[model samples]
Target: MTEVAEICSELLRIDTTNDGGGDGPGERRAAEYVAGLLDEVGIEPHVFESAPGRTSVVARVPGDDPDGLLVHGHLDVVPADPAEWRVHPFSGEIADGCVHGRGAVDMKGTLSMTLAWARENARRGARPRRDLVLAFLADEEATGAYGAGHAIERHRDLFEGCSEAISESGGFTWHEGDVRIYPVAVGERGTAWMRLTARGVAGHGSKPAVDNPVAELARAVARLADHRWPVRLTPEVARLIDELSRALGAPIDVDRLEEEIRRVPRAAALFRGVLRNSANPTMLNAGYKVNVIPGSAEAHVDGRFLPGQRDEFLETVDRLLGPKVTREFVSFEEAVSSPAEGLFDDLTAALLAEDPGGRPVPYVMTGGTDAKWFARIGIRGYGFAPLFLPPGLDYFGMFHGVDERVPVEGLEFGVRVLDRLLSSESSTM
Candidate 1:
């Protein structure tokens, strides 16, 4: 096995599942494993836990420039049910030229690549142009309250002088017909986790009550779930569409953009969610007994809004909820966007160097990342892990999905691209 794959497999076997709100087997073990690797490379690492067992590790490699790069990856994986997988989720088994495990794709694989790159450079007595802050974080699967969020809040010094950061969900190969497209994430939709509550007079189930909270809540949820959010294309997504059109040599019709987007093979699936605001009812609670009507009903919605659309999204949600139901934010993080023209050229050059004819495009992630937290401290985050996978592999599908796995060759590819990116003098065209 390649060094990158071995590191990923070893980390995967540790079982660092983060089940939100400070639950599950914390990432202490995985954090220790990563710190050990960094320590062996003669780099001193600082490890700490925001909560018991919720550990994060941070280390830095000095470069010629003071303001350097920050490359981070979460050590925690989403809880994987062993019963739902063909193999044990945490087994970290290698077969069929793939590393089969929980975090093979969602991020541990990238973490492994980052560690391997740093170790290799250390062994060869080589360093990059700017300082490199390597952070192996915890609690990413659970909203990063105890991981990136914690580190940024409690230990900001670790990331000092780092203006740009790179993390997960990008730099992977996407195949569309005869083309190989690499998407590097430049923006992410905001998180608007909300809770709705409706209160009314409690009454017997048989009685014909005019205002039943459960019925009201059900109606509100139905409206919110069924509401078709209008297409509000952000700049990042617009650039992606335009770039894809140029690369594919296809004329794009702005009025018929949605239809045109769907025509592109892999582009459609990635761009669909970012085209509009979305909210889906995830959890519902109402009556305790079938015969009795509860006075209050509650529901949880997973809502996401495109960048610069929070006000409009909230107003729309309020309108859908009506006067009978009241909604409040469970957790809210604003959408993040960085100028697509910056640092993207370097990423594209690195991918082309590894696999010529590969087209790298800017992507707007439908979901949020710990990048939101880092943005609090004037740091711009880019999703640039750099993985080249086979055309047949559904790279995005493996994220927190059943049978999550990464190709052995893909891990090696990431190591090379990331090493080049880190070693480069400038990440600009």
Candidate 2:
């Protein structure tokens, strides 16, 4: 527990804030720190950069069995503003029984736990039944272009023979009606980041123009923002609804599924975003000068679609954008889903053993992760960081949020759960 908290605090101190694209202070420093820790335990980690300063580290521990397992996490974090936070965003202050920093909960806490567990195993010369591959990735806050995406494209051999992987955002405690439910991610919504452009004749602001591109773009953005997306459940979400209903002892009526889903507090939060594809206007650009109307107005949208909903999502976007507006994908990644039946039992057992009151459930993430990139190589990825958080904490708000922190106890709990899973005989069973 002490070592876990120490490692998490150390990792948080190193500011690896990823500002997207090729910008920001890359992950080289943080990767070097992680590599140093691994090296101290007699394991030589492979540290490489996809682009200049964009570093990622990978290492493996041999086991008795030939099959492989991957444990991965991101080194980069989203940019945080100091002015908006109570403490300096990069301070890494350990106070109030929590490790306070930007990436404490979003990832570095889990990264530290993985590192500590691996280092401990290396020190004791203890190995599991299958090879354990550890990957500390970069550029996850943006797309994984310089992280997992780069690794899969340039260094495919590193993950060869690895059938499954576990990473962030899962195995955490969720309280609902006196039941502590742990929702492990089995699926992620597809990313459909698009840019919308509306074109019209340039004119002075004082002169009234019926065909104003800015006005048209604003209207389109408003429509997309206000549109009530219809509920369309994917298989993963449907399973979640059914399982949650049974777990809560509230049998769902299929004819009135939406009503029942809303009735369950846990189901409402987990299924709302996944029940429908979503598109939100994020950035907008038009004229530079106040007096002149630009001929073209452009806006960026953050879009997410469920599995098998791509065509319908795109068609809806086209209709909302109207005739003058044209759209193109800035970045796109397909939705990923993995079978949770057999694999889930192990995850559930681990959580239940640690805290008998916990009930593990399967849910879909509303956003994307490096898991999407790994899916291309035929490797299934599950979001299973394994933290046992208390009821008072807003776990989801910590991601890219102000004054982000993770409970010291939660970090310790995660270390134990990860150790149990990694040291187990068979993760598949």
User: Over the stretch 13-50, how does candidate 1's per-residue lDDT look in tens digits?
Assistant: 99888777586484888888888999998989999999
Candidate 2 lDDT tens digits, 9-68? 888888998887585484898999999999999878999998889999999888776678
Global lDDT of model 1: 0.87
Report the C-alpha displacement of residue 66, candidate 1, in angstroms.
1.1
- Candidate number with greatest TM-score: 1
Q: Which is the leading candidate under lDDT?
A: 1
In candidate 1, which residue ranges exceed 4 Å CA deviation? 24-26, 424-429
Q: Model 1: which residue pairs collide?
A: none
